[model samples]
Target: MKKIVAMVILASVILTTAFAMTGCSDRVVLNVFNWGEYIDESLIDRFEDETGIKVNYKTYDTNETLLAKLEAGGVSYDVVFPSDYAISEMIKRDMLLPIDFGNIPNFIYIDGRFKNREYDPENKYSVPYFWGTIGILYNKNMVDDPVDSWSILWDEKYKGKILMKKDVRDAMGIALKLLGYSMNSTNDSELQEAKELLVSQKDLINGYYGDEIKDMIANGDAALGVTYSGDFMDLYWDESTDFSYIGYGVPREGTNLWFDAMVIPKVSKHKAEAEMFINFMLDPEIAFQNSNEVGYTSPNTEALRRIREESPEVFELPAYWPDDSIVELSEVYVDLGEYKTIYNQIWMEVRIE
Candidate 1:
């Protein structure tokens, strides 16, 4: 029964029993582990139909979780969607395979800004999947004051009414940003300071969570929470107009600009097939459909152009893409290496508090 429920929720795409006998008699399977609810359900079925590749989809809520699974070395996956820092760590650990761009002709559609990024400087280990900034999502009716700074989360008036991210990097990154420190700070003293601040705010927080924050905020379970830009947009606009009371903004103190990218694991047996899957997703129509369903910024220029031309109104929403000022102020996290153990210890202390 648990397996049935898991299949229903994750919506893993298996070839229909009939298709297994017909089109997929010799099907190749592509195992994908990604963030939950990050892709369009229809796209999985479509990919299976067109390519005869069976998708065995799984999801993990945090980059750490993904890393742990890959490191543990029990299961094998063809492709994974990991954030920028995770990709950096994986490359350093020799966990990923270089992408063969020749098999991915649709790579030309990706925006130039998304290419040759710091995480995979040579574009060898990863392909940009979705990109966004971290920000505060608040209920307009519940919060009376201006909501433009990271300090608002620490405000005594809003104590016990805040939702904080459960993930380490994001949670500590917020504290670091609040202190005017870099989110990717390697300085031990600075990391310790952020840890102390997070511990101090533990009592004020309603709970720590992952993607459930979207539903929790929309349903009024919490007045404000730190969330990805795309999650805020999906909840505030796409989910229901009733959630119009919700607002998203990158704090004046700045935040993290994050990118989740697709990569082939070194252990993957289906390298060429994995490249085929990446190329298929980069097609303009498919990319557009994913952007619309997932409510995240696509790295594909053609897809974004089509979206803007079709729905001129989305541009009015600030959450679709942030202003240049915010983009300039925001920073991306890099592999902390040995310093990550310090972060883990600090994060564990915060959780206990």
Candidate 2:
């Protein structure tokens, strides 16, 4: 769900059946599990062709869902894409395996700020895929005022015209931010206040959604809602000062910048092949194609340069060309354990209210 500002690279396939005869005994095929529309279809084909190893492309909606499936240990998958906080949880549970950085030399192209992040300190396990901040994406015509703050979501005049996400870490995380608490706050009272605010504002919502928020907004089903920054470009509008105006911003206090990264699962059968696929994605050409196709930021330095050069138009978008204040926006989110439960309970209260 972190893909509001996401994208990936392309690759050619390589199918060599050396010690990889059986999916169980040998690791011939690499199963990649990630979010829908998170990668380029052409890249998958290229990976299959270049590796000669079968590429099993799968998708999941949330990090929680992906973690649950992996924890069940019912399937054999080599790699997975998970958000910043979820990566920490997996690392603590020892569910992830350390990467052989030697196999991923293209990783050298990544930006340093996204590397060795707190959740992935030393970045020994995960590699950043795409990242984005949480903010309200609203139609400029409907919003009526500048939307540089989170308090606007609670305005009474906007009653029954908002769309909020069903996910706790996100929707609730925004609610917490509006209360002037840390996005990573562990305080019980601060969380309780956020819960109350959500409950009060729930009725103002026209709908609660997940992936459909884009289509809904494009069709004018709602005025504004909490959304990932990456999804803002696709919402809806016309050539004129027309159908809608898509705008996004991190709140004044700050916002959560979440990154989804590719990681190897400890139970993977194709560790080597999985690493190859990751490196293929790291290739600058692949990154350029992936970023251009997906409309998200590339953590790959070289790929970003290509994107800026060829498609100067991509740079003109406000969400893509974030304001200087975005630098002030902090990198934070609630942790994995019990507070997760507290978040879920508050979500339920907001939903049922």
Candidate 3:
């Protein structure tokens, strides 16, 4: 009788363990890839709690890096946040899957201004995320000058105190714009002129950097740096930083008006779950939280309305919300197709020599 009782208890424990393992394996997991420091992480926790889907979040610094990872194809990403030009290139390659709007009902909250643009004109493949301009962030105490033009970056007096983005298109675009050529210039002569301008300005550049430019500028390590407008606003308004000495500017020659958006990759294994996540992000409340935390202009009309109503000061600052004149001066990026190789080679030469 004692041996039978012990055998029954052992069987019960084995069954319980198997059931637990099966339950764990059955839970849905969603994989997301995005730019570093671009999202509000608490939203991820909230999403997991509400939907019971596990999130595996990762980040990359540049659009080029994001493209490379997707093309290499070892891991599958359910969702990716890429900029305008990159999205255009991916769509041409059929690397992204068309998002099902029926599953993303909250997309109606997206502002119309952000929709039907040159990058994804029909809004077939991507949803607008955050939109901002590329410009200069500077230390007022370190330099006394009208922060108005791209030409100031080349001034010999500020040499070795200026930092530029290591990004290829942005660096090249600045030179292109300064020379009165289109940022998307495809002509060999125009591109070469842009390249030559960058090469000439190399001596004045203290260093080329990425997201780290925020801290470096805030700490007064460098006087001036080229960065996204949203990044500058985030650092400038940070409670920990002394705001009186910092300033941001969009050059008179114009700049890239870039948009970053979320898209489901063709390699996604969980399309439905991905759509659910995208829909959740598009929710007005979630979009507001994300924009407030990240310091970028939200593309959701409702979210922007809430922000403007609650924090009216943001609208007063041109850096956070540029006026119409500035908007008219800005241009969006388009895929360069084969011309990208020439730009890449030019970027390589600029970086190496």
Candidate 4:
């Protein structure tokens, strides 16, 4: 199985452009780094056309891989989209360049309810993008019972039919939640218990994966897999897709909340253009287009409203694009500093042993 951790860096190599900027020489190029296939590609062309500023679009599959590239300073990126805990980690490491809200007037449209959080106090470092949960994705046709919670993945009935995420943060987060502990639990004993659970789950798991879960679950190779909310949306192929039977839910104990945000990196040379791209996304029409095409929720409130109204098909599926069920259950994972090593160590044990 492909270890899905080096996601961000690998996608960058495939999608990034090396050519010099053509539209604005004085205005630096804005490098927008994110997970592969996470955004609407048309937005890139639109940004370039509107502002005459070139965008260097790149992608990463895993937050850790993205952070490694940021730390190594391999390529200067003007903007990055990382989740809540990752944004906090980047701020702590000083790898991000602060944004100037003056350049992004669209900041006003973002719901204040989502702002003023611990990761970026005063909304200085990052702007929230798409947010969602990690949960079990099962083929209703393949599974004998309903999959409304994390416990189903551990059921002996589903052994060898389960696919799990390779990342320690999300994989461990699920185990922690199932065991009725915090996804961000700091107690070493609680963590150890989660680790043990993961170790047993690993044996029953078909493979530990991240990006591939979409295809794996969709094609019926796996009945149920641990997956991101948005990934299941992307996997929806047709009526035969079995979404009617498949289910996604946070356990009663809840799962970690993931908030992807737009930020200017310290390596950025195009703060102005970077902010321009962000503002463009907040436009309701663009936000609607982005979410509809990309299979993730739009951070723009107006965009979400417009999307549900304009495109009923996008809203009428088990994907539950508009449902806030998971949002209420999310405890946005925060940076645990050096304790990240603990999760990594335990995850390795679960994978190899």
Candidate 4 lDDT score at position 150: 83
* Lowest lDDT 10-residue stretch of candidate 4: 16-25
Residue pairs whose backbone atoms clash in candidate 3: none
lDDT of 1 by residue, 91-169 (tens): 9999999999999999999988778887888998888999988888888888998888888999889988899999899
Candidate 3 lDDT, 1-353, residue by residue in tens: 99999999999999999999999998988999999999999999999999999999999988899999999999899999999989999999999999999999999999787887889999999999999988889998888998778998898989998999988989999999999989889999988898888999999989999888877888889999999888777766678756768788888888889899999999999999999999999999999999989888888998889999989888766578877677777789888878889999999998888
* Alpha-carbon deviation at 136 in model 1, angstroms: 0.8
lDDT, candidates in the order shown: 0.87, 0.78, 0.89, 0.77
Name the top TM-score candidate. 3
Per-residue lDDT value at 50 in model 2: 82
Backbone clash count, each prediction separately: 0, 18, 0, 4
What would the per-residue lDDT of candidate 2 be over residues 1-353, giving only the tens digit for each residue? 34533322111112234324444454377899989888888998998888777888899988889999998987988989998888898899899999999999999899887898868887899999987677777776677877778777788888888888878777767777777777666788988888888888777788788888766766667778777777775442223434346666556767778788999999898888889999999999998898777778788989989988887776665566555466356655636577777777777877786
lDDT tens readout by residue for model 4, 1-353 = 26565786677665553223332355556778888888889888988888878788888988889888988776888888888888888888888887888988888778775787667877898888887667777787888775667888888888899998888888888888888888788899999999889888777879888688877887789898877777666556444545555555445556765678998888887677778888888877888788777767666788778877877676654345434565556677778778889889888887888
Query: Candidate 1 — which residues are off by over 4 angstroms?
Result: 1-27, 44-76, 192-216, 237-241, 347-353
Task: Give the clashing residue pairs of candidate 1, or none.
Answer: none
Candidate 2 segments exceeding 4 Å error: 1-27, 48-52, 199-207, 236-244, 334-336, 346-353
lDDT of residue 53 for candidate 1: 87
